[model samples]
Target chain A: MKHVIALDIGSTSTRAALIARDGTVLDHLRRASGHERGAQAVAECVLDFIAELRDRGLRKYGEAARGVGVAVPGAVDEGRGLALFSANLGWRDVPMRSLLSRPLRNLPVALGHDVRSAGLAEARLGAAQDKDRFLFLSLGDGIAGAVVTGGRIESGAHGFGGEFGHLRVRPGGRRCACGAVGCLETVASVPAIAEAWARASGDPTATAVHAARAAAYGAPRATRIWRQAVAAIADAVVAGIGLLDPRTVVVGGELAAVGDILFVPLRAAIAERLTFQAPPEVVPAALRDTASCQGVALLAWDLLAEAQR
Target chain B: MKHVIALDIGSTSTRAALIARDGTVLDHLRRASGHERGAQAVAECVLDFIAELRDRGLRKYGEAARGVGVAVPGAVDEGRGLALFSANLGWRDVPMRSLLSRPLRNLPVALGHDVRSAGLAEARLGAAQDKDRFLFLSLGDGIAGAVVTGGRIESGAHGFGGEFGHLRVRPGGRRCACGAVGCLETVASVPAIAEAWARASGDPTATAVHAARAAAYGAPRATRIWRQAVAAIADAVVAGIGLLDPRTVVVGGELAAVGDILFVPLRAAIAERLTFQAPPEVVPAALRDTASCQGVALLAWDLLAEAQR
Candidate 1:
């Protein structure tokens, strides 16, 4: 079957997958991202990983992969096919598409933002399937979001459209790393919750998962920290709803893994805060960790489709 | 000269215009909206106004108007051609398009929200011309907004998109008419500022314009009230910037008449608040009060083009 090679490169790990035209994952692979080595080394590592995936796909399918799609964290100039300024990867204006294409003998390559790519995957094949308008939020180490309208992500005028992490939910509250006070990321991001829980519970290793478990069991301190995080998230979501009026809010990331513990309070908090704004169904992401891989694969297929046209 | 008829119906007055294909207002007329008389009376008045404009168009141009577009305040279901609800008009489920169509022997009628239509006009021919993405804010008796992306307004899933006024900016600060606390409208809307200024200055007839003038002159009380309004508006605009990252923000309606007094501080406040998000060019609305009429005219032309297609 005709297929594409997809890669989601993060700070800690690189996930590679073979995606068919129908979005099926024919095969998957994972490896260290090697970003700590240096930007040049990370680039070389990515090229090598792509080469390995390509050789495997050629040998197994008896043909070459049609395209390559890579999802990278941080600022991206998707129109220019440049991975611009990723602090995690320590790269600046890396011509990722061209780099991938040269080794693959001119295969079409699509580069996308990691969170946005994941959002596209969700919109097409996961929780938001058939939903033309919705907000996709990833509450990982930091919060990120994508506004999907007409089944396409809005990349904004300068490709910075969905910077939901820095939205100031509390006036003059916690200082965010982005130099803003009361940013949603400072209160509701996975690490933020984990840190709060760790301090409050006096357990150095207490994570957000532990906090959620404790909150679910009705522990006082954990429940307080969990509720604060949930309220902050609801504030940001309500702001999104007011601006976009999305029908669904598909949440993905580490916090989302807590399932009903996060969603139940999130829905109620959002509902309680809303007066005139339409309440969107706050649902957990369906694709889990493979979302970016599947999403970039879909981008590859789209590139091929556009080329055909 | 081929043209379209356009009308903007507000609570107190209705403005009508003759618009050329290139978005010029050939002629204009105004009349009392008579909405206080009842929804039926308002509907009858609308039909009569359209008939008058149609007859005038035929007499002046020796041809019938190809289409008509009406901009109304309140909830609108543009896809279904229904004005779902308008508290100002005291109407519900008004089949506006069909009502206008039946009387004019089935002339095409396009229905749209007042602020959104104004935003469309701004995007096409006014302040935001050539801007594919921007936020259009109208600060009148109440605040309303439109999210224009790719040169079209995002009406949301349930026709409630772009309700920017209700966004919680202060968080538990003021009770809004919409039953929400700290809504942007509560602090920055025309009447809100006016109320604050009136109370502080002990002038019963004081308006937002008086406060702006006094603030410009550096009057202490007026300046305080004005600063509060500007800060609140800046907060809401910053939230919009974080979410959509628009290229421009076009401010209109009554408060915008203050010009430099509002724009100068607003730009500074927004700049101060923004950390990592791209700062959009905040500008005054070029079309002023006639934006809705021109926008509906554009919509009418669009309907005619679609019919030919």
Candidate 2:
């Protein structure tokens, strides 16, 4: 049974998985990212995760992995196998795939943008699995998206195709870390929601989960905060629907975990906002955290196939 | 010397052209669309325009024409050659290609959305001619865009890929014709600019050209109005840059005719808004009004090729 090592190198943690050729997950592990220790340290950590996955795959499957796929959260130059820049990981121009693959006897490596990789996985094996044109948005600490068309996520000219988080929903509303004003991330992301709830509820230690719970329990202040967040997200989704016209919009990450609490109002808001454009089915993501792991594994398999050809 | 007839069915007028296989325009004609007369009349006008171009092509090129392509302004289901809905033309469910083709001895007809067809032309023969990934925006009475990637316009799932005009740049700012608040079209389109300038200058009969001229001549009120329009346009461009990440952005239509007056300020505003996203080279459309005609011709040629294959 041929297998590939897939690693999702996130800012918080590095998750490694051994994916079989038949799209089954054999084993997986998670480790600290070491992102705070800077680029070189983070690269070493990713390599360590890859080595552990490889060893496990060899012992279990009795075959050295055919290839590896690494999904990085940043501006990735996938063709060049470089992690161009990531504010969260404190990395720039890191030759990610080369460095990670060098220690593994020069095995082939596939590097991809995290959201796009996740989108690919979703399109191939999750909620958007049967949809040809779809959008995958992960609303976590910050919001990012994957624009999938014809069963593939568009990487754009500069590998910046799916940066939906930065779409300015408010022209002069709030300043973002990216030096842009009124970015969608500043209004609808988990941190943004938490901060808004903290301000509204006058609770210094308020979190997004607390706000959701409070809103669910019919707290006025938390409801307003949650509604505001939902409105902003709906606004962004409306714009996305108009621009991309995806058949289905699959949302993942922490915010979507709230289920119907978020989706019901979101659908209504989007419905109110849209006129000429057809409203797409806004659904929750199928795969949770394991999406990137499986997605990158698919990319690795594709890379292996291309190398053989 | 096989040629194809291409027609751009605009609301006000239908422009027809005979295009050679080598992408040269042989002859062309324009006629007022009797859109108010009914969908049947409008279809007749389109057929007339095609017939005239075909005759011209036969007489001049001395060869039997290959096929016809029509670029329709509205919600079009290109696969079925159906003009699903069009606010400007006041029509719905018009089987445009079949209506015209049935009269032309059942010659193959290729139908496309006007903006997407124009984008295809731009990608192949206009300002974005050399770029693989680009965006073409025509900011006339209404704002429409073509998202060109890999030299092909993304028609999206419902052929609404590049509707950049509808992106909610200002949430709850101004009411749009599409029933959305703060759409880019409400702020940056030619008619919107004209209306704003009319209000600012207290000139009831003011138009976008008048505003451009007044701004160019340093009229304070018109300059302020024009600056506001430019700022809004820049905001939309910023969001577009973040989302599509095109290599180039080509601005066309009547507003683009103002040249440096529009581009200078627009470029500056976009530069100010962009952070991590690479600023695409913002340029004016070279073919101007002829883009859609040539673009539809290209689509016709493509259809001809596909039919032969």
- Top candidate on DockQ is 1
Candidate 2 C-alpha lDDT tens digits along A243-306: 7788999999888899988899889988988888877999999888878888888988988888
lDDT of 2: 0.83
Task: Spell out the clash pairs found in candidate 1.
Answer: none
- Cα lDDT tens digits, model 1, B28-77, are 99999999887667778988998899899999988888889899987787
Estimate, for each residue in A1-309, the C-alpha lDDT of model 1 and write its tens digit. Answer: 788999999989999999999888999999999898876677689889988888999999987889999998877767788887675578777888787677677788899888999999999899999998999999998788899876768877777778888899988899988888999999988788889999999999999899999999999999999999999999999999998889999999988998999999999999999886668888999987889989989988999999999
User: What is the DockQ (computed on Cα atoms) for candidate 1?
Assistant: 0.80
TM values, all candidates: 0.96, 0.97
iRMSD per prediction, in order: 0.9, 1.2
lDDT of each: 0.88, 0.83
Candidate 1 has a TM-score of 0.96
Off by over 4 Å in 1: none
C-alpha lDDT (0 to 100) for residue B302 of candidate 1: 93
For model 1 chain A, the run of ten residues with the poorest summed lDDT: A84-93
* Candidate 1 chain B weakest lDDT stretch, 10 residues: B97-106
DockQ of 2: 0.77
